[model samples]
Every structure is written in structure tokens, then in C-alpha cells.
Target: MPVASLNDIKAKVGADLGASPWIEVTQAHIDTFADVTGDRQFIHVDPDMAKQTPFGGTIAHGFLTLSLLSQMGAGVMMVPDTTKMVVNYGFDRVRFIAPVRSGKRVRGHFTLAAFEEKRPGQWQALHNVTVEIEGEDKPALTADWIGLIYV
Candidate 1:
């Protein structure tokens, strides 16, 4: 992660923050997510059943991919040097464009879309995020993620 002054961080608006390291989406990951979320959908937890589907095999849940943004963003985000805390303000929009098959790798590409001071010691940042699946022509997901930072 890059550490910069608030002004310097804000200066990154419209800049590409770069891509995060690739993370493999294994069947175990899918199963754990399914168990935790109680979303026992056959396509996510049952490989044999999923094999007959269009995806060919079990696929990671869309929310599983979306939830990865936290781990992914930690690798590429810019943080203010004086920041005291940060909070997820939620996404403005999210679209799951392609299925992420189990055992495939995915990474995040982030761009600082907007940054501004919302209060004397608080700021809001909007990041345009694309989660790309390795070797795939289309990205797995895209979202506009918001964060609130306090310094």
C-alpha cells in the first residue's frame, strides 16, 4: 500500500492504483463461503451437479468474488499517512459480468475515481474496481467502491 499525505492521496483521483496480486478461487473457498453464507446452491458447493451446467463445474459465488475486494484493495490502495481509521461505505454499483470457476485465479484492478474531504478530518474516496479472472476475455465483476477515511 502507498502511504501519502491527504493532499497527495487526493491528487491520485482519476489515477490507476494498479492491480492486486492474483488469488485463486478454490473449491474449498467456494464451499466455505457457501457454508458461512448458508447459500448451499448446487452450483457453488456441488461439483458433480455443477458439471452438468453451462459453467461446466462448480463456480464461486458472485458475493464471494465481491467480498474479495477487501483483500485485493489492501494491495493497491493509497492510504493517508495520518489516517486514524477507515470504513467501508459500500458500493455504488456492482455487476457480476462473468462466472469465476473454481480453481481459477482472479485479481483486482483499481482506479481512484474521486477523492474529497467531507469534513475537517474526514474524507471520502470512490474507486472504480474491476475483478479480472486470469485467462478470461471478460472480467468477473466490476464495482464502484466507496471508503470513508478519518484522520
Candidate 2:
């Protein structure tokens, strides 16, 4: 709900283990990303070529999918106070355990993994983000996202 205290944060921790703003990985999205990142790997940019590969089709880049975590998990968290600011802290034990193929819809599940006080007005939170790929047995991605909230 609002900015939670170090202790009050427990209630919000491990909360919202879900997804929102569902998105589908399309050839177009992948192509644009390839243009931006100069990563026009056949597996990610060419559907025909990728189809012959192990994954069977072009897949979204792991980083591109990971980049959507916050967007997909939107409304799942907030700092209640207007004065509070949230800054990305970093990641923990991040791993791309699976592939997100094109044409697949994906969403994120936000689970508060841990929290700690940084200072009198700041706190750090670690969230376990599980991104699932629709119709896939394995999740597209899993990462521990950290953020610093200033109250």
C-alpha cells in the first residue's frame, strides 16, 4: 500500500507473487531490440533460422525479457508517501534458465524475497521475480531484483 517500515514491510514481503501488463514476444519486438543492441543473432532475429535451431523459433533476448519485470509487475508495489522515491538497487543471483520464444505471452510474478534498512530514510528490498512464458514448461526468466526506497 504505502511506504512500509522496516518491520511493517514484512506484510508486503513475499506479496504479489503475480503478473500484470502481459506481453507477447513477437518477431517485430525482437527485431527492434536487435537493431538497438546490435545483437542480431539468428536465434533472436530470424524466425526461419531460429526454427531450425534447438529452441524451434526465434526467442526474445533474455535481457529484453528481464527488462520488462517492473513493467509487468506494475501496481504490485508502491511507496505510499509522495515524498518517497524508489531507485533500482541491482540484482542478485540472476539467471536465464529458459528461453522466451517469439509468439509467446509472458508475465512476471513478484515475490518479496528480503528487505533491509539502509539508513534513517532509506530501505532496500529484494524481490524474487519469476517470469513465466505462456505454454512453456519452464519459466522464461528468474531473478532477484533489488530496489532502494527513500521515505
Per-candidate TM vs. native? 0.98, 0.88
Q: Give me the runs in candidate 1 sitting further than 4 Å from their true place.
A: none
Number of the top TM-score candidate: 1
| Per-residue alpha-carbon lDDT of candidate 1 for residues 1-151, written as tens digits (9 for 90 to 100) | 6789988987889999999999999999999999999999999999999999999999999999999999999979998999899899999999999999999999999999999989898899999999999999999999999999998
RMSD, every candidate, angstroms: 0.6, 2.2
Model 2 Cα lDDT, one tens digit per residue, 44-126: 98778888999999989998998877677565654535336788878976889899888889988778877667788877888
Model number with the top lDDT:
1
Worst 10 residues of 2 by lDDT: 75-84
TM-score, candidate number 2: 0.88
**Which 10 residues in a row give candidate 1 its minimum summed lDDT?**
1-10
Clashing pairs in 2: 3-80
